[model samples]
Target: MKDRLLERLPGTRTATDEVRGAAAPVGLVPRVSGFYQEWITEMKKVTWPGRKDTLSSTAVVIVVVLIIVAFLGLVDFALGRITQSILSF
Candidate 1:
């Protein structure tokens, strides 16, 4: 199977075929165009998240981050006050 593949594509391994000891053409143009072709084909197979799921995930991330930021801010303010009190003569 790999032998047949080697004959069909006359170029350096497409970042994957090289592992199977396939022949890779040492040409820069072929390599770049090959990468984009593979990328487009793979992207077509991807099942992207739906709009509602994406927005819900974004909101959840924002809320969690805001909670963490508020907690850190309170901790910083409390530490600043404690340090100021200790330094007072």
Candidate 2:
């Protein structure tokens, strides 16, 4: 099944063939065009998140960050006060 799929793909040489040193015609123009064609095809298949989904995810991240910062700030303040009181003696 993998062999059949690779045969259908545009590239002239399969991995085995390339490993066995079966030289395919190396050309700059054809390689660039083939790369771009495959890239565009892949880009079309991507499932991008919707605007609402993106906004909700961003808001969740921001809220989590703010909660973490507040907790850290409180811990720092408590530690600082304890250290100052110990040094005052």
Candidate 3:
């Protein structure tokens, strides 16, 4: 038993040293400084819309939303009238 424990001492010391070396923390200053550079690089890759394309896309969205709102309003008005007629009878 004594020889077995003695033999394991070197392995345990090597494992502990490796863990201590590998577990060291990283610094934050370099990451913070590179953020603006990273952001500008990403923005350059985007395909931004022109004035005519932007206006047409915006108009389409507004028209579709208004049509949906009008349809819902008509449905609600019809349902209310039907309910009122049934109750008045």
Candidate 4:
């Protein structure tokens, strides 16, 4: 399985060596370009979320944040009232 996976990888050591032997030594520009090309290739394989999934995830985050904020605000208010009563007495 790992051998098959390695074979699927872009520019594995043996492939890189063959290409390097045929061409000029890889310079910084080629290296950077190769990195970006590989990155784009890998990105293409990614399973990105659909628009509906993204929207639902965002909505869930917003709802949770609002709930936490409300709870904190209520706690602060209660603490403030208790402090005031204690100080007055």
Best by lDDT: 2
Residue pairs clashing in model 1 are 11-25, 12-24, 12-25
- Model 2, range 20-70, lDDT digits (tens) per residue? 985644899878987899899999999999999999999999999999999
Q: Name the regions of candidate 4 deviating beyond 4 angstroms.
A: 1-31
Candidate 3 lDDT, 1-89, residue by residue in tens: 97658658755554446667744235677666677678999999999999999999999999999999999999999999999999999
Instruction: Encode model 4's per-residue lDDT on 1-89: one tens digit a residue.
Output: 99878877787665556766756437999888888998999999999999999999999999999999999999999999999999998
Q: Rank the candidates by TM-score, best first.
A: 1, 3, 2, 4
Worst 10-residue lDDT window for candidate 3 reads: 22-31
Q: Rate the local accuracy (lDDT) of all candidates.
A: 0.89, 0.90, 0.84, 0.89
The superposed Cα distance between candidate 1 and the true structure at residue 70, in angstroms, equals: 0.6
Error of 3 at 85 (Å): 2.8
Q: List model 1 lDDT by residue over 13-87, tens digit each.
A: 575656668576589998899899999999999999999999999999999999999999999999999999999
The window of 10 residues in a row where model 4 has the poorest summed lDDT is 16-25
Any runs in candidate 1 off by more than 4 Å, and if so which? 1-20
TM-score of each candidate structure, all chains considered together? 0.72, 0.56, 0.57, 0.56
Error of 4 at 2 (Å): 31
